[model samples]
Target chain A: MKGKTIIKRYPALLIQGGRTQKVEDWVAVEGSYELYLNDTLVDTIVVSPTDLEAHALGYLVTEGFLKPEEVTGVEQQGDQIFVRTATKKIIPRKAAHQNVIYRRREWGEIPVVSSTLEVSPALIIQCAQQIPEHSESWKKTGGIHCSVLFDQEGRVIKAAEDIGRWNTVDKIVGYALLHRIPLTKKILGCSGRQPEGMVLKAARAQIPIVVTKAAVIDRGIEVAERLGVTLIGFAREDRFTIYAHPERVRVAFSPHLR
Target chain B: MKGKTIIKRYPALLIQGGRTQKVEDWVAVEGSYELYLNDTLVDTIVVSPTDLEAHALGYLVTEGFLKPEEVTGVEQQGDQIFVRTATKKIIPRKAAHQNVIYRRREWGEIPVVSSTLEVSPALIIQCAQQIPEHSESWKKTGGIHCSVLFDQEGRVIKAAEDIGRWNTVDKIVGYALLHRIPLTKKILGCSGRQPEGMVLKAARAQIPIVVTKAAVIDRGIEVAERLGVTLIGFAREDRFTIYAHPERVRVAFSPHLR
Candidate 1:
């Protein structure tokens, strides 16, 4: 881990209560990582310095460029990761349709996840609250995003942090792929807002539930609903809002009946 | 205005206080916008579906794809904006260098903003606090980002909201360009974190100061300092942190010499 370079202190002028003071503040490092497939540049992502390998692999997978099994080898040289896949999956440059929000690889097909993984509301809130404690960079700089993957039994499979929320998800997915951990039974929790891109990452990974400590946009809910992913937002403290696929939440008791 | 579709109500299951309730919640709309320069594809950006003309023009200028003067005509057709420029400034596909973070157009030149515009710390705080009140979508959905452009005298030039921070900056810049308002003396206030990409937008537009109610990553500060832009982060309530070019912040009184 590049812990030393991840959070560096910088001189700053702080204004508080109508007064100014010079202070040194710890700031998160934002760096770029390049992904290469068979020596061809796939894309460049902005992320924290840590977990470059996981980020690269996960980005390729979650972005639907490469399936996990298609990867034959992975190598990291400096800020770039060169991966040899079974076949070169060249990412398309244009929008699948004019309405594609992100620079999508292909809007060819939307994968439907049928994981059927169920979790209680308590577990969802617990994981959402744990993001702050798990995020080391966020603790120091109050910047960067944290993403955690949990097993069906609420065990921490892996946790990752990055300057970009998408990078954090990509890191988590990459870690699972590297360790050969099955993502079908995992629940993904993020500390950033759930946009269509973020939800699509969890859906592509076949993670059943996505919990966030922030809001979810309209398209995210639409995608989550169509893809059979359980989308939960505002997941902080003792509450969370389930935007789609509420069946997998497994509410044990109904207060409405009483 | 797509006001009806901007904030849509979705049925959600709210889990709170160890119980669940069915409720309808407001969610901000996230749509994809494609920018075509002289019938050629420039890029597709994810944003809230409003002020798209400003977004298209702003995106073109801020991303260094086209300068303000180069833009001759802009027409909106559904989700796509067809732009005719004085010159076909095709954005380069490759990274200018190996270490480029975002999918930059070109890393060829770093423009140094020489605008000596200064502002009081109180005005910065006031603008930072005013973001919530000025943001209509945020007031309803809490899922959008707000940005405002202010002149050196602290007058509001434009205020915009979007699902992406970069879009907000683009909107502000586009608005300035279309209205023939110069950005050299403008202060850009955002309700999002300051990253290298965000700072570069301000620099590219010649905006002297960038303020945010969030943290400034290390790369953001580095870029801001190199490009001669004032970066103020965590500008909320009565406090703010000046990460780069603190000289632009004209603090009349300092307790340090006392």
Candidate 2:
């Protein structure tokens, strides 16, 4: 049987004083592609052609499929990507299993590391307050995911919008990688649930602090605790709970900044 | 400078239908497990441990890092996952070129052969209308993604919700895999953008029909066109655009279904 396909545009809908209006729209096209290596199918990915090469490389590395040095050249002709490997025989073994093993043997068994920063109720409140204002797409389409990068001062630095939560994080990571931004210094603030994958992405980027206004799954907490990455969730006004790595968030003795 | 971590949960205030409610939210959890190949480190993935083995296997296959038969055994202890491979040497050489190669090669190329199915505008409207009613979490927290599976009659069979769009689809796919459900006769209705990843997932599952109420990107269209999958987008009450395989969507001349 065959599959079906459709195309549509995203219009910036504005609601002012209960009146809804279309501001602008952009034509968005979508499709799937299967990736091949040396005439053998490797994997499949979904993305835009605008930055196909970078996406391929980043996805492979992040997923532990390929290393940087092993690739001699990457060429794209039409829709097919040919990756030249320095090794004559690419190991038929899958890299994803290796990643799982590495996580278990090295970092998985480590005791949950304690953080130094002490989070305050006020900080969580402040972060939650910032979400509604920043989520322009949500207000427009009632669809879309958002990832925001913030400094220690709780100010937004870079915000990315996507249809998927993981994709938004990946885009931010990709953006950070392109600009040579120091990821460790930033806190990842997202409007999506903090799952294991979300924490993993932050960990891969070496981001220490992850804050969200949504619920955190158990696996996400477990990963964060193991990675020494602080995981915080349920950001609202004047109240919060610490899951793991509580030391990094400094709680003010008084309401005023010291 | 050493990275800092902050973990916390917050009380959230929800605003729906001009009503305000408060809930305790826990977002981030630390979960870490490593996989080992004969005491060697290969890769790592952060995901919910509920289906660690399946996730590991699926990850390996989807990432093009390992084949199913190449894996000998998969064991999960607590939060850690260990996957043993038959091959002794496994090295990933494409780590550095991850993003670039993936995007360019996959997105730029369209499939050569594909199948398409035609859907009625009324059915599309019904699917769109049903989405909001099925989204419980979104109605509560306004933060979640949904994927619904429907039979040819446009009756929804199952609906899955998740913090990540991919996860929702993965859960549905995993469910189908477990139940031995054939996807060739169903339509995948999503509340997210039709990306190459989403389309590839449907293709991998051999699903024949994909319908979305959101915008479609260029690559998504290309993939559906090539895979012979019917792609439909902007599935609203009165209108939709078909990108490929239009022959399958049988339209009746009469307004009534006979």
Candidate 3:
């Protein structure tokens, strides 16, 4: 690990129990990073200072701007990232920006996920609970969101943390792609709420199962249902709710149901 | 109050304590909205379906795309919002998109807030605690983020909620602008993390104080300090952390210190 700086000390007044004290607080670091794809300024992201390459790659892959295998090289300077892809085609500038808030209808039909990966409820619960343990920056600053990737056998492949919830998901996606970890049979665990953007990221990346320790919005359910992705929300303390494609999760049969 | 549909019922599987049952769950609604300023397509937003007008106005104001007073009329047709501003000048197409993830360095100098408003910690704590009460959508779906605007005397001016965190802040800003509520002496309470982009919104809108029930990152503090905005974080249960400009919050003198 490069151990990029993710937290900084700041002065703060802590008020508690009718008393106030000045103290040095640990705060998560956030900065604007310029991302260049094939020598073109594609976009800028205000994200945690670390994991610039992963952020760039993940953003490109999940946004349909570029596929993971298409990338030829990646280089990061002070606050700018330059990525060289194998293709010589120029991406429409309008499409690059518009895709940030992409409308499902305008984007045409999204390919439905066809992964047949199956995992037990216990495995998902374990992954969701393990999110906090893998988040070092979050432990230090209490301001970061984390996402973890697990292989088919419930083994951790990699994890990422960012000040932005969506960035964490992109970081993990970028990490998996950079390390050549196949996403088809993996489970994604996030420490943020499940929204349409997040669920769509998993669907686009072909990650069949997504579990979160937070709530899932209506569009998240709709997108997950339409794209054939399994979404689990409110996954904590050994319980969870499956909003879509619950068949991917194996639930034990109980005689009380009869 | 114009009530747009903010929640929808969805089918889900509730799993708890070694049991799983099929149930209907209430989820917060999210949709894609097109925003046109002066007959020019500006941007698209993925936000909650309710409060479309406020969302459009707030987004334009906080993003530095248009001044609130410059807006002559606003119309909502289903999923699209048409905003007619008084100014005839066309907004640069590139500026509209690039500003979404703006780099402070590239945006030139930001106006420093000069408000001298002061309030007691009790008022802020009250405002922070009131966030949950004003969040009707949150109580129903548990997926929405709420932003509340309070006047100098701690009276609630308006509150708004959305599936996206930043949209809540923009909605309230738009609400204040629509109703001609001055933001100079107002306090904004948010139910989401404080980041640089969020702090910049308060600064650009001239809201002097910002309090949140969530954590504040380092860039949020940097922006608040530079822009002369009072920033508070982790404001819950009568305790709060003042991340920047602590002087705006008056602390009562206690003899125990002597």
Candidate 4:
């Protein structure tokens, strides 16, 4: 459980109804943590400050840096994560400063999401309602973005909440990899906008259905459609928009009927 | 305008009332844009894909990469942003991947925000209502984050909308720097969570007040208090929670009176 990685209390003035009242409320704490590969700085993340090992591992795995078992061990300092893999490689100076934004035309060629799991609307709404309950930080600060990996029966596999939506997804992925929780047939649910990066991460994991309580961006829809991953957005208690394969969701989504 | 960086249309399947419907809607287009510093890769960003110059300038300035003026010119190709700074320095390998997460212990040493502008609650509420009108992408995809720099009389100085909240702030900051828009005594309003990173960006610019339609995390409050900036969160049509510096707001946010 990567819950309440950091939370601090502060007195706030709630000005409403023409009245001012002071109340103590919990606020999400964000800290910057550095990740080092072979003692060379690779990345820095500002998060709710929980799950450093998992974050480092997941980030490495997703960024194509390292495989799960390839890493011998991970060490952590105050705000730094050190991952020692089997081979130590110094990142090329030119590549080190490469801040890149990329989209591949061939990403949709082969979709790994071949799960036959049937996720009903009830199941999605049930999970969307339960997403906030899994995070103490979100309840306290209303400031966290949460991601939960759930089994077919609504059992939460691994849950992670972070101020950065990407970190939350990374935490979940790391938890799954470390615990060996299968992702292929699982449902990934989150409370943040689904951009292409988020969709790409889930698609890479072959997560069948990605559900959210927020809006789905245009690229998110494209990636999901191309990757054969089902993307459900604005997943309120009763309604949801499926951008990709709805047949796999046990619902007949008729785009032509409209 | 950075408006419609990319908008793609796709047929979507809708499920509600135990019914199936198909519809066509506008989806946000996200692409990976490689940022270059004199033909050297600096960073990559996946965004809905508008406002390359603003995004490049804003990202450079906020990330402490370079001052806006240091950038001599900007060139864009399909999905690449090439920033030509005063000098093409090969960032030392060590400094290349230097990911920094910074928190200042003494951010309130001297309040950069000494503006006497008394913002009425009505003004904040009015701006909150007006923020939605600024972004066409948000309306279409329901997937964009928008920010506005508003004046004392409720005139919007610069407004930006992006898939990344950070990028949205950078766009606004870049607009200000490019157009020489005055930030002091102005209000910066956004539609995302007020985390420390966002707050620090505003504080660094000496913006007196920062408001959001979302919640403020604890780190955001601390940063605002220490940086002599007023932070207003959970701002809705008629109400908002003032986390730090309420006197600057016309409403009596008396933290000491309690």
Candidate 5:
């Protein structure tokens, strides 16, 4: 493992009607891990190595670098990780070279799958409310991105946290893949705003609903709309805005249920 | 024009000693424009279309979708832009498609350029402070990204403001290209953290110095180090962290400069 360091800070917390309290003693760790391919270095990513295997696999697949089955083995030794793949073609060495040249040879464009799940404003609010509860690391360190998987009943089945937002999502997806969970029935909830890359990753994973506490950028909304995915933004406790795929949300005003 | 709207808000100002004050009556205009290539709709980006030609050319180059010289003609029609390329082949219809398939076909690896100019910490601080003075729109709407160009004498020559950080940088670069400004002697001052994309853009422009008021990610630092570019982060008035190219910073014992 690489030399890890904890970052501590005190943040002012506001409680009901404007009462403010200062909370200190929060802790978070930061570190970097270099992923090698059969002893040859491929890429380096900044993340919590709690689920190192999942992070390696998911990052490769999402970044258009590697496929799931292409990864033959993943081994972590000290601070370095070895990712063995079946292909003999090596990824470029220099960062700029790797970005511009080898990016084409390694991966293909991700396909966007349409989602059928109807999400409601209330569900989006619930998703937002549930995000904080799932963020164990953030509550402690005030630094971390969280990804939660929720079923149709609004119950969170799995959640993961990491220093990087993409890593967090990758962990959740990796966990689902490991457990053989049906991702199509789940809603992915995040604390950060939905960017185009994040939306693309979700679409690639075939997740039906993506709910976030922050606003969705124009490009993200457009991509989600094009992919027929339901995107909910500004998902506060009592209100949310449905950017696209509004048909998935079923709103019923029945007195009997109340 | 697609329903022009001016947004006015009160932004919290972080002044000296962490004291906050509400600055009211800040105004900003929000609009979205669609870019087309050879009559085929390509993409829509949300930005102020004041410099339509520069925005179009820069977006294509930065996105790795097209080269500057590859563009045959660029025409704007009522907020809609049409870019004609020399080749008859259409790149792709969607961003995902372009990212996956067409991205690698057009561009190769970015060239790494060695820097000759040494940038100092004091100079980086001066650059950051100079960023605010050049943000004319931010003084109005408090919602624009500023890109400042500084010479060896630490004089600000070109400054551009846009809603997108990349756009702001592109505007400065476009201005430099048009005005025949020697980029090797210039430093780029930005308000946001360094991302891989931002670093790549700077490298492509061959700018020697990149100073930011925000933190730099590990990948950004690594890229800067590999490219031999001077990257200064956390640029406060009297202190800043030199991530890479530390040799560029000349420390002076004079108390007047410190």
Candidate 6:
């Protein structure tokens, strides 16, 4: 797998209080990857050097560079991702550098996710617990953020980790797109803050539910509500906080339990 | 304060085990701000709504768009930051959409920082512990990353927080640049992973020591060593690991303390 090639153990001096000792430590690989839409290089990203295929595809989709179905095949060569597409089209003007955050593609292009999945407080916590089990790179470096796409039954379908939280989410999104998985039918659980960017990714993919152990920001709640997605944060153990579109997540109602 | 203008308090469904209820939660604000230089829109960034001046100036300096001192005044209107610079000499053709990560300036432009600051293990952990005290947004939302520029004595000089780790670093660097603070003697401590990008920021400013409460990736360490920086990671209450250039840090020898 590409993972083993992306992690390395190096000697480090550890200090606890007044003591110091040398030990070998695992640190995730971080590098810059140049992505190309055919021979035309489109962008470069500094990310964990793993899951190059998903990263390239997901980046194109999230950044409004390409659609998943239009991309024929993704091939990787070291720190580059070469994307083969159905037909060559025009690339828009380099946006005003200041407004590149939003692409010209209208948010209306995103489908309203229509998944029938119900997430309980217990289920939210379950997905988080399963992350460490699947994220070997995270266990080694603790420098990576992991994203998992869980099936309708709350079972882990696919997981990807990267040094950048955005990269991790992009990888998972790419994974889902590459495999032709029904995006609306899955839940995305992550190990990074569910900020506006993360919520936007979920909304763009039409993923119905987004869960994280980290807290959600004000804009995250706004986007989740606008896009009709359920955003839950501070999901630890059996405790969680739902910020928006709670109707999408079905937890047993028992006021007496409080 | 711009912070109060951006942050919104909303009711969240808090769940503990089987109990569910609503409580008002404080969440950090996330917004996209378009930045302009002399009315020429230069770049866009998704960040916390506070510290617009630092965000704009830091971005310009870090991206090699303009030196920090060349900027005259920074004005903000909603999500847009208008940068007034001394002159509008040239605006480079926008880099290819795919390769925007790197500006025209090569990595070689970064000066090898040669600060004479010697950090101790106890000092690194001390900086990490102090971060929570200064980060109000993080205390409320836990969705923001904090970065503090510290003097050699392990005292906090200035702190900045944003939704993106890169923004926080850029802000701190901008602060140093705008005020003409000597960079070589300062240490940048952050609440994010030390990746290649983070190290590159420190190197660009010629900051000698970069410390974090998280882990440093392989390339981060590589760049730090090459740039003559001391990189510390996994810094906690009384423990820390030094990845590169240990000679820049001094810990007293006392095997008995182990």
The clash count for each model shown is 0, 108, 0, 18, 5, 8
Positional deviation of A150 in candidate 6, in angstroms?
0.8
User: Which candidate do you rate higher for TM-score, 4 or 5?
Assistant: 4
Instruction: Give the per-residue lDDT digits (tens) of candidate 2, residues B185-247.
Output: 778888766655567656655677777777554445556766767776656655554554555
Give stretches of model 1 more than 4 Å off.
Answer: A1-101, A104-108, A252-258, B1-101, B104-108, B252-258
Minimal lDDT window, size 10, model 3 chain B: B98-107
How well does candidate 3 reproduce the true complex, by DockQ? 0.04
lDDT of 2 by residue, A123-201 (tens): 5556656765776545544345567777666777777654445545665664565355766667777877665556766
Model 4, span B59-164: residue lDDT tens: 4443335544466777777667777867774433233221211212234443455677777777877777778788655665566668888988888876765555
**Maximum-lDDT candidate:** 3
Count of clashing pairs, candidate 6? 8
- Per-residue lDDT value at A236 in model 6: 68
What candidate 2 gets wrong by more than 4 Å, as runs, is A1-91, A95-122, A128-145, A160-186, A201-208, A226-228, A234-258, B1-91, B94-117, B129-146, B158-185, B204-208, B213-215, B233-258
Error of 2 at A58 (Å): 25
**What DockQ does each prediction reach against the true complex?**
0.03, 0.03, 0.04, 0.04, 0.01, 0.04
Regarding TM-score, does 3 or 6 come out ahead? 3
Backbone clashes in model 3, listed as residue pairs = none
Could you give candidate 6's per-residue lDDT for residues B76-134 as a string of tens digits? 87767776767764343353121112112235555687877886656766787887678
Which candidate do you rate higher for lDDT, 1 or 3? 3
Q: Per-candidate TM vs. native?
A: 0.61, 0.48, 0.60, 0.58, 0.45, 0.60
Q: Which digits, one per residue and each the tens of the lDDT, describe model 5 over residues B2-43?
A: 332323232212222222222222222223456787777766
